[model samples]
Each structure stands twice: as structure tokens, then as C-alpha cells.
Target: MRDLYEVLQIGREASAEEIKKAYRKLARRFHPDVNPHDPEAERKFREIQEAYAVLSDDDKRSQYDRFGTVDEGESAARQAHARWAGGRSRVNVSFGGFGGFPDLGDLFGDLFRGGGPVSQAPETPAEAAVELDFVDAMRGTAVVVALRREVECEACRGSGHTSEKVCGRCRGSGRLIHTDRVRVRIPAGVADGDRVRAAVRTTPGGEVAVAVKVRPHPFFERRGDDIHTTVPISFAEAYLGAEIEVGTIWGPVRAKIPPGTQSGQRFRLRGKGVRSVRTGIPGDHFYAVQIAVPRVVTPGGRDLVRRVGELYGVDPRSGLPLGLT
Candidate 1:
């Protein structure tokens, strides 16, 4: 994987403003809308999004700087487990500590030699997938998910045997699987595939990682933190300057449609896009102007259009070259 800083074309010690500036420049240049049908540009755009997703956040950026990764979900899970272990949990599952577990080689050797009963492996982290609306993801929300976790058998005290006989409660496995409902807090501006961690109260040192999936919006499209949309303007509105209501993720806002505004012309609304979940800074919204033409024209309307056309002294395409360059 490319370094986040390298992906953003900035130095490792670049300030937040510099990073944001670089990201915006690159994003506009390689945006999918601007470079349609170009797979390479699309790939670069995704890379930009991923890099900014991590580097934009202080905690994730710090972790990436140290460990070369942004495993915030795993880190949060481990911390939650630590807190749970400190309380009433008798069995603690340590991830990377000296007191966690026996050496793998020795444990395997003992298992082959039949030296004694082998210890149970730590339970795998549970996963729960949650779907969110585009606006919901931009605004953050809490969701409840059902998680199935493995709990130690209370009948045998996690020994798998009682009085030299296999425990019937756990079927000699020393573990019991149970389902519990866990509520996870989803942060704002989370893109698809982002994960959030929640603790499993029923199991010792157990956690559930919630994977986020955002549904596509009908009109609003997201590109990183910014929002993009096309607003259609009537011919009169395009010819005569007017204040039109533009739809945004937040709501409709009045925007000016300047006189002589051409189709495909883009306008930006500052601080009207999504607010970053990490930095709390809002992004800008971009809207392209599309001139809507009338399907049917009356005789009087045709005369009016001809009169309007007379205002342009020269042909619109007079500058175009007929031959290929």
C-alpha cells in the first residue's frame, strides 16, 4: 500500500491545511465525473479517498505514523476488552502481551506429546454489517446489531470436564455460543467499508466490529467529503440572472444563477457539504448548471427565440476548426 502522505502528494510532516489543499486539488483533477470512462483516474481517486480517510483523522493518522496502519476498529476493540477484563471478567484474552498466552511452538509441541490439556484458543472477533442511508452516514447515528459470541461454560468453569467426566453443559468444548444485541455508534462522514467497534457485555473480553455500508443517493453523489449534483435551470433562468433553490445534503439553499450561465458550468457552495467526522470541518458542495430547453415551441415563442438569437452577432461555434489537429 502507498503511504497516505505519498498518496496525497504531501510530506509526512505536512500540516492539516496543506494536506487538505493537496487532497482537494488532486480530487478535482482526478474526479470520476471529470474523467469519466478512465479507470486509472477512478483508481487514483479511490486511493485519494482512502488516504484522506485515515490521514485526516488525528487518531488514525497517529496510528498510521507509528504502525503503518489505521486499524482503529481493532484498537478500539482491544481497549474495550481491556476495560471489560478489569471488571468482573475472570478470563482475559490478551492480543500482544508477554502474559497473554504460551509460546505457539511449545503449545503445539505439548499438544502432540499429550503432556496435558491444551488451552482453548481466544474467540475470534465477531462481525456485524450495518446499512445506512447516505444522509445518515453523513450525520452519524447509533444502531443495534445482533452478535453471536462464544462464552466460557459456567458448569465446568471453562475446563471442559467436571470430576474427571466431560461436562454435559458445553459438550466438552468448555465454550457456549450465545447471541446478544449490541449497539454501536457510527461516526459521521464514514464511507462504505468503515468499521466501528462495540463491546460484548455477555462475553469476557469480547467485541463486535460493525462494518458500514452506505446506500447511494438518488441525486446527491459523494466524492470524499464533498457532495456533487447537477441542477437544471430553465432557459429564462439561464438567460436572466435569478436566485434558484439548489438541493443539498442538508436541504435546499438559495443559489444564484448568473445571467448567461452556460450548461455544464459548475458552482461551489462553501461549507455546505459533509462535515468531517474527524476534524469537524465542513466540505464544499459543487453543482453543475444544466440549461433545460422547452420541448414544444409556439409560433410566437419561435419568433421570440429568433429575436433572442439576433442578440448573438456571431455564431457560437465560429471559432471551431473543421480539420483535426
Candidate 2:
């Protein structure tokens, strides 16, 4: 048999949550209903089931890890039968008749006495991608997503059989494919590549995982929780100081540009950035000041510019390094 960790495609030190996650992913891909009549998929699905059964239980996993097998004394057939029975009930097989052979009818009857074999397939979460506007990503919004997921068959109540017969509705798989339009609420300050989980009504504890893709804003950029933007200001505003309206994720707010502010100088507006989704605390917004030069088309305007230029006591580029060290 393949290593259980290899069967689940996880590392040896994988946690219980990781084991469950890997099982759900592989089970969904190789489920009998998903790949009908495919012998390879069926074999792999059974392998995944076996791997999960042992590793999911802490005691069994510890035993397997220490001894390299669960219950080394038991024969393979008995171990397999025990696993299939799930320790719910026990049957005594008597080889009293027919040349000392066990009665097939009695064994089969006891195995399928209740509702046939329990489905080992895990409930897989549905996945969908949602694209959000930049502003919506910052402020949060609800979106309707189309998803397809597997839900238990109501006819058999998740058992493959009903009244000692296979359920026709689910073809004995005990599950049905369902497509639904679900509304998912994305929390504030969700970043690109983040996944948001939403509950599904049909399946208890089932979730729809939506992958977020935030559209790029033309002027604003996000770094962590902080928002960065370049705000253009008149040259006079930078030199003489002025209060201007600045745009933020929340809205426009008044910000002051200090006197003698140079181009590319950054200013911060405290608590004006995107709110942290996990902490609920707003971040600071940082905007770089870009000096916008006005065109001097008139002779009077040129004269005014020259008069302003004369106000500079030293050359702006005097301190700049002109040679490589």
C-alpha cells in the first residue's frame, strides 16, 4: 500500500486540518459520482478514503505513525472489514454448513443490514471567483455568485440505500449535484487573492469559497492596509501652503500641505485609509505631493513666474550629487 501521507499528497507532519483539507480536495476530484465508470478514479477514491480514515483519527494516526500500521496483530481482511463496519455493529460468521464454508448470504445481510456501506466521500466546498471594484474591496460589499456543490440526497438521507434497496434518485451515491445562486458578503479591506467563505444552506457546515480579485484603481494603490496615492497640487500650494480636499477610500477629506513642501514629499492623513478586515482599525493614508506647473502663455504670467523664481535664495539642484562616488 502507498504511504498514507503520499496518498493524501501531504507532508508527514501535516496537521489534522491539513489532512482533512487534502482529503476533501482529492475526494472531490476522484469521487465515483464525479468520474462515473472510471476504474482508475474509483481506485484512487478508495485509496483516499482509506488514508483519511486512519489519519483523521488521532489515536489511529499515532498508532500508524509509531508502528507503521494500525493494529499490527489483525489480519488485512479483518482490519478492512472492521474499518468498513465502523465499529457500529458486529456479526458472528459461522462456517457450519456447505463443506465448512462461511455462508455468503448471512455475511452480506449483516454488512448491508442497515443502509449499505456508508459513503466515505467528504463534502467538498464549492469554489468561485469574484472580481470587485477597488472601492468596493475597501468598503466591502455583497455579491451574488453562481456555485455548484454536492448535497446529500433527500430521498435516502445520505445513505446509499432506503428500505433495504438502493436509492434510485442518487444512483446509490447518496448525493445530488446542486447549482445555486448564493449571496456572499465580502469583508472590508479584502486583498487580492484572498478567499472568503460563505455558508451553504443545503449542506450543514458546507461553505462556498470565493476567491477575490480586486480591480486596480487608476490613481490609488494599496500596500498592506495603507492606501498610497499621488495628489497633484499647484506649485503655489506647495510653496505658500494651502488646505486642499483629498480623496480617500472613505471619501474626500481636507488635508494641509505645509509651506515649502517639495515635490514628491509624502503626507499622511491618520485613520483615512482602508479599515483592517481582521482588526477593524483604519490605517493611515499616505499621499505624495506632486507639484503641477502652470503654463505661462501670457507675458504677464511669464513675468509673475520670473518674479517667483527670484524668491529662491539658492539653486534647487545645488546639493544634488553630479558624480558617482
Candidate 3:
């Protein structure tokens, strides 16, 4: 059985980030979530998790570095991390104290090995959020934005130090070395709240540009070459015949209603929807009419009904069995 160190291919001396990074990479590659029925992947995932558990803890790391057993794979990786203790110290010694002081070499060795330190903090990327409405998304829009980022220090040029105040650890190389890039494009006809990713890219100085969040719009919804809207028409306009105006992205347009039009009748306003950002040909807008009914009838309304009733008397239910009886 391979131990955790072997699974991640790292030594006990690995830092927290190193340990976590290696573990995650292996876990994702072998995770059952991505690999459905592969026995090898499942076993590998378990081994990596166990290794991460031990190496991720500092106490376990110290113990493993000393009494570690020989696993063909883990043994090699552990040695590479400098967890073992066998290196020659460059210290010079003399039989007795020199003319006025101890040998400078021995003093330097003690001070350098026991006290001198070297390491640096890597620069992380900047992040932000952007918003796009449905109309903006469907038509495609460019936006300019401002961001407060961790830029290089003008004095030290981000080396984190100056001749007078430079960081002894980094020697003024303001950034660590790593490079990655990501890019994203917004597609046409994307609905509100849809996401467009921006690819990460590395600068000459090694900085990460993360994706900004894109916001959603409330007013518009997009479909290919079609826009939809609800139109309300009064019952009188629908039943007695009249002209009704429909709202579109461009403007309001009149859609004629023939006599005795029914509720839920759809009216199509061609060439009034979203215009193509490329070709510029406009799409169509479809209006679905809902008839609005009045709440109460007046006495004059009763007279109108009576007169209309006189026009078509006998039996209003002519097709029913009651009419036949």
C-alpha cells in the first residue's frame, strides 16, 4: 500500500501550500466524481487523502521525516524535500583564538546557519466584479472598469525593499515566479444572470488576473431572433374591435385588432426585436394579449346588454339540449 507522501510525490519538508497543492491535483485527477467506475482511480484517491492528512500536519511531518519506512516511491520524494539531516557545514576552525578575534569563517558559519533566513511571499492576483444586463449580454458590450490592485512599489519596483529598506528575504524581487492565464467570452442570446469567464493571464512580472463576477439584468430576456412581451388589452377593445399599441425595444407600435378578437391572441411585430450586433438585421417581437375585464356593470351597461339581447332573442343556448326541450 502506497503511503500519503508517495501519493502526492512530495517530501515531509513541503510547505502548507505545497502539500495542499499536490494533494488537490492528485485527488482531482483520481476522484470518483470524475472517474465513474475505475478501481485504480478510487484507490489512488484514498492513498492521496491519507498522505495529505499526515503531511498537512506539522507534527506528523517531523515524525515521518525521521522514522520513515522504505516505500520505493515515498522514500525518493521525501529525500528531495531536504527532510533528512546530512549536509556539510562550511565552518573553519583554528587551534586557538587568532591575534585579536575568533576565525571569521567559524563565526560566519554559526550566524548564517543558525540565524540567516531566506524566503519570500508570492504575489497573488487581483479580483473584481462586473455586471451585464440581458440586452447588453445579447448584443455584446464593452465596459471599462477601475481596480485597486497590488501593483509594484514605485520606489523599490515591487522588490519589497530599497537599498535602505529592501527585504533581506526577497532581495527586492517583488514577485515569486509562476504563470497561468484564463479567458472568457460572452455569447449572444445569453439570458439574464448568465456568466462569462475571463481567462487568467500572467504578466511579465508574474501576476494573476482573476475573473470578475458579471451581474444580471432585470428588464430583458433573450432568445435567438425573438423577444417576448405580455400585452394587456381591455375586454372592450378585444370584443368590440379597436387598435392596440404594443411596446417593443425600439418603441411602441400599433397592432390592429379585427372585430370580435379573442383574448390571448398573439400579435407579431416584425423587425422590432433586438438588432444583431454583427449583421445589424433586427429580430421580431411577439406580443401575447390578455384581455382585462371590468369589475362592475353600471345601469347604462344593463341597458346596452338588454338592447343587444333584443338583437339575438330566442335561445342563446341554441346548441344545448335545453334549447331542444
Candidate 4:
């Protein structure tokens, strides 16, 4: 009977990860299906399995390592030695004198003698997501995100075989680790809040993703393809005909006001709004005229206003039909 560590072929202080790694490697090689009818291979495989069953279970390992048995004065080692060396390999071993293991002869008779192979489970793949700044999303920028992914083993092309394995630099795992920078293009005239979807740049399993963010612009208020903003005008500018320089989403442009223009007047700058990414067509910008009225009135100004009022007549609302619902 060998020490459990020797049977598992790991250092006594080996971490669980190390233990698992060793176990996987050994199991792959010694699995009954792979080995067929080699008696030594069968025995070694059973020993590996038994060792893992104990060590992988913390409580069992702790008890076996500490008191040599769980909750008792006697040791499992003593009974186990007696059962094996005593030529009574079918004897039962108890835990805290509670439950007993049926003899290896009856319980795992075929297993120890040589049993059929066990099935292997398939593995699951991984996916990743990423975010970007406004400008990046609009103009498209390349970013590095730490992706946790498992590629097929290059050695076995994920088959786990050495000679037949693909380059593990890729992993027998089919996909190769990307070491080069990739290019991601962003379209022009993209708004502050929008998404840029891209396919897998150059990798297996086309990765679908969105670059979420906005791009920057100094003078643009986007509304569909139209932009909206206010333009200021002096009282005289609104009352008399004038062509004033107005600021639009694209830049400063000239806008004309008709005679007797009032405040809150709307003017459109055609083909000057946000450009459509799909259509590549420019939209329109609407200008709202704000009249700058004098907060304080001078004597001359008052006289002039009075004269205009007399000329225009006092009953400005005379023609209204107010009560009509």
C-alpha cells in the first residue's frame, strides 16, 4: 500500500489546482477505455481514483491526515493494514463506527477486476462584452479587453493528444491567441448616444458586440437628422428687414428676417443638420429668433412708442370673436 500522495503522484503540499491538473492528466492516460486490458493500468487507475476521492474531499482528507480516522480512538490505517496484509481483502472498514464500506470484493468487484469505460463530459465555451467612449463609438476605436476564454488545445487541436495536437500556442484548442492589433471603423456624423456593432475582427466564433458611446461636436443638437437652436436678434433687426449671421449645427450661416418679424420666429437651414450614417444625406437646422427688447425705456423712446400706438389705434383686439367656443 503506497502513501496517497505517491499514488496521486503529487507533493503532499500540492494545491487543489495542482492536484486537479495532475489528476486530469493521469486520468486521460490511464482511463480504462484508453488502456483496454492491462491489469497494471487497471490497478493504477483504481488507485488514482481512490486517492482523488479522499484528497479532493476536504473533510475526508482532514480526518485521514489528522486522527487517521474520523471521530474515533483507533486508526483507519491500522484496520486498513490488517485488512490488506491480513489476507482478508474483503473486510469492512468503519468510519466513527457509523457506516461501513462493503468489501472491495462485493462492492467494486468488476471495477478492481477491470470494468468498462466511463463517459467524458463536454466542455462549455466563453463569451465577452466591452464598452467605449462617445468619440470611440462614433469614429470607431480599437480597445484591449482582458478576455477569459478557452481555446482548443493546439497540441491536440483540443483533443488533448501530444503529437496530433495543434499548436497549444493556440491550444489543440483551435482558436489562436491574437497578439496583433485589430482595426475597427466607426462611421461619420454619429450622435452622442448610439451603438456600433461589429463582427469578429479575425477569430473563430464570430464575436458579436456593440461599441456604446457618443462622439463630440461643438455646435450640434441632433434630432433625428434635424438640428435645433436659438438665434438672437435686436428689436430693430426683427422689426425691419435684415439678414443676420446665425450659428447653426454645422457653423455660422446667414438667415434673413422679413419685415415686422416677431420673437420666437422659426427659420430653417436646409441640408445643415446631422448627416445620416446610412443615407449620407444632410438634414436641416431650425433657428428660433429671440428679440432683444430694451429693459429700460427713455423719454424719447416712450414718445416714439406712443406715436406708433396712436397711428396703429388703441383697439388692437377689436376684431376678435373671444366668446366663440
- Scored by lDDT, the top model is 2
What digit string (tens of lDDT, one per residue) describes model 4 on residues 68-107?
5444313443443344344433332221111222222222
lDDT of each residue in 1-325, candidate 1, tens digit only = 7877999999999899888778766765455543445688777876776677677778888988999987763454344335424532332222211222121111112212223443364554566788899878988899999877688999998999999999999989999987887787887776554455555656443656566677888998876567889999987888897899999988999999889888889999998987865456777899999988889989999999999898888999998998997
Instruction: Quote model 2's TM-score.
Output: 0.54
> Where in model 2 is the C-alpha error above 4 Å?
1-124, 150-177, 201-205
Q: What CA RMSD would you report for each candidate? A: 14.4, 19.8, 23.9, 30.3
Clashing pairs in 2: none
lDDT of 4 at 230: 79
Candidate 3, residues 1-325: lDDT per residue as tens digits?
Answer: 4555667998755789888778655654454433335687666765665566567766766666666643333453344223211221221221221222112222222122223342243333333235566555665665443333344446566667877777555557674433222333544533232222232343322322222222433433334345667777886687678887777766779888877776787778888876643235667888777888566988998798678667555785687785555
Error of 2 at 130 (Å): 0.4
lDDT of each: 0.70, 0.71, 0.52, 0.53
Q: Give the C-alpha miss distance for residue 316 in model 4, angstroms.
A: 6.0
Whose TM-score is greatest here?
1
After superposition, candidate 1 runs with Cα above 4 Å error:
1-125, 153-174, 199-207, 321-323
- What's each prediction's TM-score? 0.60, 0.54, 0.40, 0.42
Question: How many angstroms is residue 278 displaced in model 3 relative to the true structure, after the best TM-score fit?
Answer: 4.7
Q: Once model 1 is optimally superposed onto the true structure by TM-score, how far is the C-alpha of residue 96 displaced, in angstroms?
A: 29
